[model samples]
Target chain A: MQRSRLGDLTAFNQLVERYQGPVYNLALRMLSYEAAAEDVTQEVFLSAYRALGQYREGSFKAWLLTITANACRDLLRKRKRRQETSLEEMVETSGDRSVSPSPTPEEYTLRREVQREIQQALNHLSHDHRLAVLLVNLQGLDYGEAARAMGVSLGTLKSRLSRGRAQLREHLLTARGTREP
Target chain B: MFRRRSEPIRHQRVRELLSSYLDAQASERERELVERHVATCEACRRYQEELRDTVQAVRGLPQVTPPRTFTLAQAPRQRMAWALPSWGTPLATATAAALFAVLILGEVTGLIGSPVAHPTAMPSSEALSLKALVQPEAAPEPTPAASDALESLAVQDETPPAATQELSRSSADTSPPPPEEAAQPPLQVPLLPWLQGALGLLAVASGAWWLRRRRAIR
Candidate 1:
């Protein structure tokens, strides 16, 4: 971090290489779109690089993820401002509800179906709840780290996670029942 | 198990505990209590299992690799380049101050020579009155060209102490001008030098502070 702050491009790129996957995935899940997630991932790294001086010591990953979360939120706000529909609406409109070709293995098909259902269920969550779930459950940050990354208290994290999980479970179960037997 | 309906508050608390327990985030004692309660309680056990599955499903979502290396050759360097001007703010301010001091000094020494102070320039009515008061004996009805020239010179000379003394001498010869006109103090003091010195000090102080901040950041 010190090297990067001193304008070392190699050190900064090393940081980006290490974190790009998690950051990209976080954006993907939060946004439920590949292109938007890609843009946000780049934006997050660029913003992090410029703000390297302001970064304090702690979990670098948490700090990076914090930037990612805020960047995603800002993009979402911009999308909202364009008189565009909510993220859920975007997800629903772009979502693949069509059945896979039979030539594909049934197991792979089922897996893809489940993935889509999970994404749709995630889309139903409010932005905060979705972000909490993405950070803690998907990104594997513990509650404390996730709370810090989300800039919320631990108690608030727990509440959002609990509510988010309950809603997700309900949606998944309902979706599964409708699709499967 | 049927008695669980009578303890709604306890049921809610246990449900919250179960949610945390599934994440392995519950306190040790809370974990123990949740474990014990779920063991005896069918509803709580089912709720815990469902939450656990939900978490697993989310975790099972495959991680996607970024479509491309979100890397750039010179973006950060470009940002640094843009920021270079921000660091030059103090230097710019100091340069501006120096230029302002030069202008003021030139104005004070009449080196830059304001057009308003030229002898051939037209004099306002007030300048004519002051000129009449300063040089009462020169002309009661001087020619237009001479009066205009004399008024201009008188206005230009009005900045010096010698000019004020000359006015006092001329007023002594007259029946004494109105008190308001007499009470007017000379508009010029050694203000230009004082202003130039203050500006120089400010420029030095600003440059020093900027250097100190740059050192601290380094």
Candidate 2:
């Protein structure tokens, strides 16, 4: 952290390498577009590099996740403005994924199906609720860390997380019902 | 009747607590209430299990690898390029306007591009020849000899040539020449306006650039 703050590029790149997966996944889950997620991920790292000076003592991963969340939100806002698409509309349009021809084995297919179902459920969530759930469950952040990342109080984070979980539970159950014999 | 009515409200409260309890984020009292309710209520137990499954499914989602490396190709600049404050455009505009006003004032006050003052004119064609010779166009580059000749002309303008001739003849080398204002190079005057104009244009360009950047951000 010290070396990066002193303008050491290599040190900052190391931080990028370490946190890129979590950052990229967070962006991917939040934005739900592969290209935009990649863009937001790149934006997040560059933003973190420039803002290294302002980072005080805390979880660096949480801080980077905060940047990632903010970048995703900004892009989502722009996307909303340009397309004027609401979240519910996006979920309805994008939730159903047609199964691709699986060159991979059965386990991979099953996993992909499960992943798709969860991503659809996440997509169905409101922006704030989705972020709260992702930060805590997907990213494995503690309540405090998730709260910091979401810029909400612990109470608010829990509230959103609870609502988000309830919605996800309903969606997943419906998905399961359709899939079952 | 009270038990049936209160059961639904208790069920609702317990469902809320189950989410936090699953994450181990519930308070001790809330956890105990949820556990006590779920131990007997089949519906609440199923809700807790389903909520837990939802959280686990989300957590189980595979971490997608980034399509490509996100490391910046080059070291970032010292600061965010767009970190300019809202007043940046106005400040640049004000600076440009102030410099423009200064340049205009300079031209209006005759401070810039003013010809050097000729203190006195001799009553002869010698002064006319000197004036013609010293025209900036004719003598674009002033030489030392031209200034010295002008100085001598000024001395002659104040004291008649005949009297200087008599004085020189009487006191061979005793009398000193009178003091005169030094001639200023005309090159300096025209350069001032160009410099100020360049500065004003630079300021205007930067102001425009800042305005465009701010709009793009919005």
List the candidate 2 regions with Cα displacement exceeding 4 Å: A84-104, B1-5, B80-218
- Which candidate has the highest DockQ of all? 2
Report per-candidate TM-score of chain A alone: 0.88, 0.88
Q: What local lDDT score does residue B103 receive in model 1, on the 0 to 100 scale? A: 62
iRMS values in order, in angstroms?
Answer: 6.8, 6.0
- Per-residue lDDT of B58-106 in model 2, one digit per residue for the tens? 8777666666788777987755556545565577667767767776777
Q: Per-prediction RMSD in angstroms?
A: 13.0, 16.5
Q: Each model's TM-score, in the order given?
A: 0.61, 0.62
Query: Residue A48 CA error for candidate 2 (Å)?
Result: 0.7
lDDT of 2 by residue, A1-181 (tens): 8999888888888899999989988888897777777788888888788777667777999998988887887788898789866544443212223233334577666767777778888888889999999999989999999997777789999899999999999999999999895
Question: For candidate 2 chain A, which ten residues in a row score worst on lDDT?
Answer: A92-101
lDDT per residue, candidate 1, A52-79, as tens digits?
A: 7657777788888888878788787888
